[model samples]
Target: MAMVITVAIAVATELAIVGAGPAGMAAAEVAAGHGVEVTLVDEQAVPGGQFLRQPPPQFGVSDWLGDPVYREGRRLLERVSADRRLEWIMRSSVAGIFSNGDDDGDEPFTLVLNPVGEGDSGEGGAPRQLSARRVLIASGCFDLPVAFPGWTLPGVMAAGGIQAFVKSQQLVPGKRFLFAGSHPLQLVVADQIVQAGGSVAGVLFAQSSSRALALLKHPSVLLGNADKLSQTAGILWRLRRAGVPVRFRQTVLSANGTDSLESVTTVPVGPDGAIDSDAAEEIECDRLGVCFAFSTSSELARQAGVDCRWDASRGGWIAKHDDNMASSVPGVFVAGETTGVAGSDIAALEGQVAAIGCAAELGKIDARQAVELARLPRRQLSRRARFARLLSELAWPGASLFDQLMSDSATLCKCEGLTVGMLRTQLGRHPDIRTASAAKLLSRAGMGLCQGRYCHFALTRLMARQLGVPEERVGGFTSRFPAKPVSIGRLIGDDS
Candidate 1:
């Protein structure tokens, strides 16, 4: 195997964090406070990640949509900024991670960083290299795509995508909107739109109110998360006061438009989870927002040869981590969504735990001290994780929802323009192709710019349903280095 070429150009640090989101920022703060030299890197120009994405500095927008979480994020960003030992690499992405140690021992991790905007004057925008004794992966999660008829319409977008535009850029996706998704986060997004002076036509929640209320069965979990409950309830109240129709057990069956999204068809889901087509209703709207759940952005962890397994509650395959957030790799640690689909609170705690683990492993803190430092965070993590599990169960998409929404003509792989009919036909013609990876080889389903991030979960479910197997049997595609596309010039180095 090719090894990470360590040259003089590479900067060295005691700890290197791949993402500057909540988990990463928290991890950097803790490590730096403990006198460790740390480097924090993120793709965005800001540090808040997706959950707490901030408006651009020039936007002059002081209102954080009346959400307290954003205020907390601002404070976290300030703390990260004031840390003298923490180095911030903004507007850049980690192109690849290279290390070789299967036989010899743990090797120093070398990360290739590619600038996001404005090409550096050099061959392939010559990437900078960072070598670290210990690495933490907190790459976070992305919006899960739901494939349905007319979903490729110009005005249709993922709910989280719409929120990102509204929150980070202060740009509304459309004048009038309809939100349909499995998670309650969609309602939160709708609240944002309304708060931003935009109109929402309606909100369709896939899970019924009774199903959601079932979470209350774990009273301690619900009571422990009283703050989150209050926030959610407040958002719901605002939507109600704004006259936004929030309907439960309803999902968008299709989107329709000639040039852009003009209307959407929705149907009530019965107790059995099948769409009650007899009660289908068509509502006109300029834009449609849809999402089911989120999948962990674990490409970097996978690239590092970390062990992973299919986790349904987490939305897909996740890197395996222990109580200390240490991954299968000796010197590499993982936290936040990269490990699983827990929310931002759990992610922050995980980061602190990972930092403690790293400090102890590096001899900066003794084992006893590390254990003492990790005790409270570990307890908090367990409590939050239990509540997260309840939330996941409540928001879990019904298998029948996919069957009702996705038609044979609906596009599955947007990057390759592959439709459901095309995929089904391919599977029928080749019975031997059972797994998603095998289907990718035959049909090019996931061989596009996204590298299957958008279509992997949907494709896996489709394949599993067709083959009468569990979703786990149809595994995800094997991730490769430079997970996202980078200029060829960067890969070859700046010879000029």
Candidate 2:
């Protein structure tokens, strides 16, 4: 005999905001202020997304990092918490999105929500449903994994992951660390490690400082984002003061260790963005922090049947959105990294724009009022987006990095244990395998717990290389429902 559990379902709201990141919080505040009943759902216990992630109250952690983003996030959380029209569903994830009705009429988007217990345990819980007239997806991004030898080692971690552990948990991953990746976030992480009394062996950036310096040519752009530039400068200054070696145009070629990361082999990138094989060098470190960049967490949007297009600079396969952040699907809006890889500032602005658009569509506000309310946010979003593009271009991983770094023995899909050589063998057996999805079917490369989030980008690049086509042409895999895994018992609730 099988056991069954019953859980009560909550009432539906006029608007539902998935993800409580800056974008979701901003959207909820805006919509609630306009007299719309808004419910914000997020997987984390705290409301802030990764940028504004808050430590548990019991942790007694203060804002020692002095990040303006976190300060702003705290303010946003307080304001959103105080909104009477808004409800927060914490530690809950959207299992799936089901839509009914046609675009001609008001469509109802149903969210299957799975609420986790303390410490995110999946045990002893039943799924619930929440329906909304309009849904706004503000799902943020995760670190893009770059595959190489020994990446599966225990001490190897994403740069963002390291930052989160250090900032939120006051935990140090390792004593000595090698930070190798693209983006300024790595530098910030390194500084955090140093402040926490850990050692940073060195910092290696795949892009050259010359390209970043060239941004100074655009004085107006820099002036407009003076605080951001200042923040970057401060992080770099701390790293310099700590005597951390910072090298540009360099990337990790391989990580080596017996059971955990012990050392990393790095190579300088050439002018054409290919690794200089002759210039390879090895550095000793206990841990390696690497992140190529970020990929948009657009799985929810994709599962909702919204159209997406390939944009490499924006971290690939971003959902299509109009000026108001409304997707092709009627009554569905997308904001933040779900639409693209723009950072938290642009995400907040886009969230406001999305809320206004959704409010007008839902009859909470007139079209004229919505337009007037959205004008400033739209302008601010455009300005922030332009700056974000500049940063993305600077941090964009080199095209040849994958081909140069990935070895035949390296594990490409860590979840499924599918390696580069195994993928090659599958391609050889099935020459018809041209896209990532087809490769997944032939080799089970992406059939894993993560559902190909970590390996899809690399797989796309690999397939493109195998087929002699562009990466975009190779494309990505189809996202299925229950964006995150859910238990069968939870799916089928108790009859009583």
TM-score of 1: 0.93
Query: Cα lDDT for residue 183, model 2?
Result: 69
TM of each candidate vs. truth: 0.93, 0.93
> Which pairs in model 1 have colliding backbones?
124-489, 124-490
Compared with the true structure, the alpha-carbon lDDT of candidate 1 equals 0.81
RMSD per candidate (Å) reads: 3.1, 3.1
- How high is the CA lDDT of each candidate model? 0.81, 0.80
Residue-wise lDDT of candidate 2 within 1-496, one digit each (tens)?
4643334675688899999988999999888888888999999887788877677757876554466635666788788867777788888888777786655544388888888662233455677788788999999888888888888888899998998888778899898999998766777789889989999999887877787455423322211223455666676788888899988888898889888887898999987888887889999999899967788887888889888887766777898989889998878899988887877777888899999998898888998999899999988877778776876776777657777788788899999998888888888888888888888888888788788888888788887888899887887788887788776655565322
Please state the error at residue 417 of candidate 2 in Å: 0.7
Model 1, residue 120: C-alpha shift (Å): 12
Off by over 4 Å in 1: 1-9, 102-107, 119-124, 213-226, 494-496
Model 2, residue 75: C-alpha shift (Å): 2.0
Which whole-number lDDT from 0 to 100 does residue 22 have in model 2?
Answer: 84
